[model samples]
Target: MSKADEKYLDIVENILNNGYYDNNRTGIETYKLPHQIMQFDLSKEFPILTTKFVAFKTAVKELLWIYKDQSNDVRKLQAQNVKIWDEWMLEDGTIGKAYGYQVAKFKQIDNLINTLKTDPQSRRMIISLWNIADLKDMSLTPCCYETLWDVENDRLNCMLVQRSGDIPLGVPFNMCQYAVLVHLIAKVTGFKPGLFTHVINNAHIYKNQIEGMKLQLKRRKQAYEAPTLWINPEIKNFYDFTPNDIKLIDYKHHEKIKMEVAV
Candidate 1:
């Protein structure tokens, strides 16, 4: 079984057996756990779940829309046929002062990249999207809101902080995309991909997703090996990457496990 699947399933099992049931703002009750973490070494293998198929290309598109394009327009994602954010898209044709808006508003990606290139050892390399002053303007507040970056021995590392995570539906997508982000940034900055760490303050599974989550749990014993991530060798610039340029080789997984979004 892939290490990613092992760690993810462990969390799922933990929540199912030990989590506290609680009501939240989304109007759905959840089985909640706190302070859950997952870490991966990119050099060993790309961390993507093997127990169920993750929409890797779709995740990449969403990541680019937020970090690379630095856009708040849902239209741009719709242009690529990605609709994950359709639920939160506002009538103004954007997601308000959330996500890409925050990135563009502060030019956070540019600043981080420049810092990695010019001041590799700087302790201030961070990108944050949780803008307190603009939360009221956002259609949805950012969940995976901050990223702290570091460089050592020509290797790039990242730590992602998420305020809340929808374990069954959202965490899988978030995990793979951020790992991809680490690789993309490492390539652009002329460093080897090192480690990617994810921390979720509140990780929960909605009541409606319980059955599907249990179905996935049953497939744990059959999980396949980790897949290799292939990035186009010629693309040194992060902005030059297209979905075609990033792919998984031999990504064998059980099947798609559908679950409704709580939002």
Candidate 2:
């Protein structure tokens, strides 16, 4: 099993079995443990779940939708059969100028990639999508808000900062998607994938999601090993690539545990 899967499953089991039950702002009372972190060394393996089909293509599409397209439209996601954001889409068919907008507004992607290839030691290599100025305009704030990229020993590393998380509904998808980003960026910028770190400030299982968490935890230990990721060899540009360009070479996983998504 990949260390990523091991670490993630460990956290899932630890929280469900021994985390503190608490209430928070969303009225989505939770079972939360403070400051839980999971890190994967990508030099050894890709950090994707083999225990469950992680929708690697779909996750890549969604990531591109936010960062490349810079679109706030749910219709674009719907066209791709990804409805994960349906609940949070506004009546106007937009989720506000979130995610990709921030990326474009600050010319984030190119700037970061350039910095990574140039002065990688610079601590300012962060791309943030959580715009406090536009929060009220959004149905829901971006979950994977801040990402810091770095280089160590000629390999690319990334750290994703999530301010709030609904573990069952959001965390897993975010983990796989961002890890893919780290891999893709590494490929585009001429470096090997290194480490992927996930930090959740308010990592919680909602009251309604307790049973589901338990169910997932029951199968967590039984999760299969991590799978290999394959991106099209011809695809060099991140923005030009689509769902068709990325794939999971051989994913293996247990039965998926159903869970409610609390908006």
Candidate 3:
């Protein structure tokens, strides 16, 4: 089994058997421990969940739209039939200061890329999108609020900090999304992608998702090996990458496990 499945199953089991009964925005529920972190060494393999079909291409497009284009337009995503952010778009079709605004304001994306190229040893490499001043203007705040980057032995590592996560809905997508981001950045920055550590401050499974969680837990032991991702060799520029340029090779897995999307 891949480390991702093991970690996910462990969380589900803990929630089902030992999680405390509690009430939150998702109503009365048993929640797994929050602030529970899982780390996967990307050097071994990519961290996508083989037990379920993650929208890997869609996730890549959205990530690229945010950091590469530095855009906040929902129509840009809608043009590609990706409506993940449609719910959060304002009437004017922008998402306020949440995503690309933060990228542009601090020049965070370019700075990180430049630092990775010139000073890979720098410990201060970070990109933050959760601007407090811009929160009130946003329909929804950023969940994966921050990323801290590190480098070792010419391999790039990333630590993603999410302030909140709806395990059945959002966590899986975010995990794969950022992991791919690490790989993309590594390639553009002239290093191999390494570890991806996800830290969730509020990693809770909703009450409606209990059965799905239980179902996923049953297939945990049957999960396949992590898949290897391939990016086009000739694409040197980060902005030049499109969905067609990113590919997942030898992605073996059992049947996909479907779950409810928490609102």
Best by lDDT: 1
176-237 per-residue lDDT for model 1 (tens digits): 99999999999998999998999999999999999999999999999999999999999978
Candidate 2, superposed: residue stretches over 4 Å from native: none
What lDDT tens digits, residue by residue, belong to model 3 across residues 76-178?
9999999998777898998887787789888898899999888888999999988888899877788888999999998888999999877767888788888
TM-scores for candidates 1 onward, in order: 0.98, 0.93, 0.93
Q: Write the number of the candidate with greater lDDT, choosing between 1 and 3.
A: 1
- Summing lDDT over every window of 10 consecutive residues in candidate 2, give the lowest-scoring window: 48-57
Query: Quick one: best TM-score, which candidate?
Result: 1
State the TM-score for model 1. 0.98
Total clashes for model 1 = 0
| Backbone atom clashes (below 3 Å) for every candidate | 0, 2, 0
lDDT of 2 by residue, 1-263 (tens): 66666776677677778778877766767788767787888777777665555666778889989877878899999998999888878888988878877788889998988888788888889999877888887777787899988888789989999987777767778888898888889888888999899998877787787776666666656767777888888877778877777788768876666777766
